[model samples]
Target chain A: MPETPTIPDSPATAPLLRLSGLEQVFDTKRGKVPAVSGVDLKVEAGKVLCLVGESGCGKTTTARAAAGLTRPTGGSVEYLGHDIHRMGAAEWQEYREAVQYIHQDPYASLNPVRTVLSSLTAGLRKHKKVKGRHEARQAAARLLEQVELTPAESYLDKYPHQLSGGQRQRVAVARALAMNPKLLIADESTSMLDVSIRVSLLNTLGGLRDDLGVGFMFITHDLAVAKYFAWDGEIAVMYLGKVVEHGPTPQVINDPQHPYTKALIAAVCEPDPRLARSKKTIPLRSAEIPSLTALPSGCTFHPRCPLAESGDCDTTPPTLAPLDERRRLACHVVARDHVAAQAGTG
Target chain B: MSEEPILSVRDLRITYQTGRNSEVVAARDVEFDLYPGQSMALVGESGCGKTTLGLGLLRLLPKLGRIPQGEIVYRRKDGTTADILKMGKEELRRFRWSEAAMVFQGAMNAFNPVQRIGAHFADTLKDHLPEGKRLSKTEIRERSEELLRMVRLEPGRVLPSFPHELSGGMKQRALIALALALNPQVLVLDEPTTALDLLTQCSIVEELHRLRAEFGFTMIFITHDLGLAAELADRVSTMYAGRIIETGTAEDIFYDPRHPYTSGLINAVLPVVGDLPQLASIPGSPPSLATLPAGCAFGPRCEYVQDRCREAVPALEPLTDRPDGLTHATACLRAEDVQHSREVVSRA
Candidate 1:
């Protein structure tokens, strides 16, 4: 039951962004659509935090609200000390400049007719950071070189169509890096590219975090990519626009506390035939996807919980109870270790 | 393993119209044979023509694609060979699904959402079945329920529900049930579980395996996941840029890969759990079909590429002294050298 969550004092390590109980709702014809609800997020300096979920799970809305693009219906996004929901147009522009958002579909993110050089220098010229044409060209070349688009001259002269899918994405990343932003919100940036180029792009993200000390909020549906990208940062698992579970990466993946988390872990494909990892797939059809307009009662995932019965999940939303100092899971099964133990030794 | 071949496709060629003067050779001079009571996999990357080959076997290539150069000889049980390519439109339509059925990857669009799952089976059964063996309503329900049970779903639950009521996996199973309605001579499943998750993928694939075993139907499983292919298929074939680079047993394909593309792919997929040995991948993407190289396609990205490789494209030559040497082939001039290097690496 969500009686009252203890508001703890902030940790000593300076977290760049801290969000608590953020909710984004849309007034649709059917009803109010709560796209993002009760999401608590924390990202530290130089760390890459990944918010992973399937499509339409409110992960995108949370990122938009944090960047001060979408105003929240409830809760607050605390950027250091200031609440982003209360920021004005000028303040929001400053925040938008600082927190750059890189989107999926690099082909669509870039202008079809524009030259790569022009796209890169637009932000620099708009901000009045660079002087004239020669200086802009030099800066553009520098940014392109930083992203490993070799020689820099080859990419600058070409259009989006002239470049490969991977090259186009590199240019997009270069355009984002031009502003020297604080936090990077990459929403499924590499999902559109071919399988072979995904790892190399992720390696670049890892390199950027280490070299520039820029906090990255990398979002993806592929768990394998997420595991490879963010090794140490906490992973926040979202379900129906709520932060269902959040903890250390290794803990949540290896020994998932929540039922939804367990299902996600079980879903990772097992290649080896003799070792049957695919056997325990728990009939995913039971989870009735809640319509955003008509939200489910109590916990959003409660209707689909394999362990849930009639009144247990219908009336109560479990609190994020402390399983340990670094781990917490909001599930009734987790609260009682005895019940989980029986199911654990399967 | 069979003395009698059920379906034999020889020298098949399929190309896509990339531009006004250019054509993308989707499947180039491919050849394979599928017999009864066995499973074969066509594994490759996204645009590698595995699906094209699957559709080609049924003479179902998309618009602007045609089998300009080969014969698909399906030897019927009564000793009559039906050359599918030579068939007219009416003959092609008659033999297509009832003779060899396919289950697509996504089931949402594959099925009519407004119709009940039970109605789909009824349509197929009524169209094919003769009037002499006309069944009652209860008997039809029993048969439909039995089909659902074979795929490990409740017949009543799936029968009454619309397509939207079922999950991705369940809908796929229902499609499988529809495919088996006529009990065709062979079954072709095209990337059947691509969109589904790992667990759901396994459940659906396991159902396919069980059904194939119980019904004793021949299968041509098409997929991109090497690990999934290795698990499901008895024999594996890997394709790259519209060409079959390797065909062998699952062990030979996964444990001992001949093509650089196949090896690179196996090396890249991150293993889910445990202390798996480290994997190395190929650096660059698959080369464009429009501007293919003069010689070998993989030579640009291959570490083992030599001076002779750039001169002439090497044909697939089988290991002479090996068992079923005629059946196994690799398109490399220095197959002996590649084999030797692979063996040394394995030992190390």
Candidate 2:
């Protein structure tokens, strides 16, 4: 087992970003549909909090809400202990500059008509006042260098179409770093790049934690990447729109408490022939994810939960609560089984 | 060991004519054999020509693309073998779905939205059926329902519904069912579950595993994911810059890769077990087929590269160090040194 990454445990130091009971509802033609509901999470300075789930699980919606790209219908997002949604105009502008967002499609996010230097300096000139135009150009070159786009001088003049997918993503990161953000909300940022290039981009993101003291809310559907990149951080497994399990990365991954987490782990395609050929448990619980508009009556996952019982799992919705010092799980069956095992032993 | 292969490819080179005088070598000197009831995986990143190779086997290359050289020998159902690249128009059409079928990449959304789900399968069945053995509508519908049930879907619920009514995973399964409607001897799937959720992908792959055994068909699973390839394929081929850099049994390719490109690919994937190890990413992008280097295509990014490596391209040769009876081959000059270093690192 890998050693768990050391995290900041003291309560005295306030969190960099805190999301309390965050809820988002979209008004469809049918009715009010809930995309995200009653979620709580936090990220300290230079720490990572990975949000993982299948599509339509509200992971992307939550990231957008945190980045202030999409406004939530309920609850508050507190930045540095202040509600960012309720900030004044000047403060809101500053908050926008402090929290940067990196989207999934690097090709679509960048302006195809503009050169690399023009795009970087355009955003930089808007936020910060430079001594002269030459200084802004120099800063743009430095930003490219920071992302390891070598010679920086050659890349400044090239269009986005000329660069490879991985290089284009590096430029996207450089564009975000121009603002010097304290928080980064990356939503599937490395999904478009090749497998060989994803790790390099991940290392670049990892460098930001040590070099710039930036907290990250890394959102992805891939659990292996969630475990590898955020090894020392926290991982929260979301089902439907709620986090079914949240804990330290190693604890949550290795000894997962919730059935959904267990199913996800079992489903991962390991790069081993013996394991693939052997008869292992598949945990193929359901045909597909249930529609969010007409969610199940009790736990959103009960319809697909193999270990779910009749009366309790269908009637009562479980709340996310600490099961042990290491993790928190939102599953009635697991909690009941834990209590029963303790009673039998003690 | 001397039995004829179901499909044999030798020295296959496919090129795309760009303009008046320029050409892009989409695939070059590719070679492999697919035995009956065996699953082979062709893996590489985007633009590495794995898809083009799959298309070449089916003789479905685009207008600009043509096979400049090589032979794709396919064993027909009547126990005779013929080169797929040389078949006439009518013969090619007859050989397409009945002998081999392809489930295209992102085929989940490839359905005609206006048609019912049952109609899609019926259309495929109708097109491929022999002229004298045409089936009635009721029989086609029954066979379609049976195929749907084979993929673990409800025939009653899904048959009457339009393509829009089904979920993405259901649509993908429906496409697979359509591909298997004719019961082709060889089934080629291009990134079948690339964009699906983890559990959904697992279930679909599990279904494929079950069906492959039940139907006894050879499979060609193509994707950029080495992990998914490891799970489904008995033999794996790693492609780089329009050529097969390594080919071996899944166990050999995963545990004891010889080529630097193959090792770099294996090391790049973030393993789900043990400590989070350092990912060794190959530094440069894939070489452009239009302007390839002097020798090895992967030489620019290879860590163990030497002067001779840049001057001479290494052929894919069998490893003598490996035990006899295993067909493990690599296209790297320093394969011995790399294999020894890997053993040392793993042992320590």
Q: What lDDT does candidate 1 reach at residue A85?
A: 64
What TM-score does prediction 2 earn? 0.95
Specify the poorest-scoring 10-residue window by lDDT in model 1 chain A. A1-10
Model 2 whole-model lDDT (C-alpha atoms): 0.85
> Could you give candidate 2's per-residue lDDT for residues B229-270 as a string of tens digits?
888988899999999989888888888889988888877887
Model 1 Cα lDDT, one tens digit per residue, B62-173: 7877778888899877879988889887677667666788887677678988999999888766665633457677777888988898777898789999999887778888
Least well predicted 10-residue stretch by lDDT in candidate 2 chain A: A1-10
Model 1 TM-score (2 dp): 0.86
Task: Assess each prediction's global lDDT (C-alpha) against the native.
Answer: 0.75, 0.85
Model 2, residue B128: what's the lDDT?
Answer: 75
RMSD of 1: 4.7
CAPRI band of model 2? medium
lDDT of 2 by residue, A1-346 (tens): 1212134234356588877788999999988779999888889889999999999999999998898888899877877776788889998888888889998999999999999998888877876655578998899999999899999999999999999999999999999889888998899999888989899999999999878888999999988889977888999999888989999999988888898998888777767666566625546468689888889988888888889888878888899888888688899999888989989999
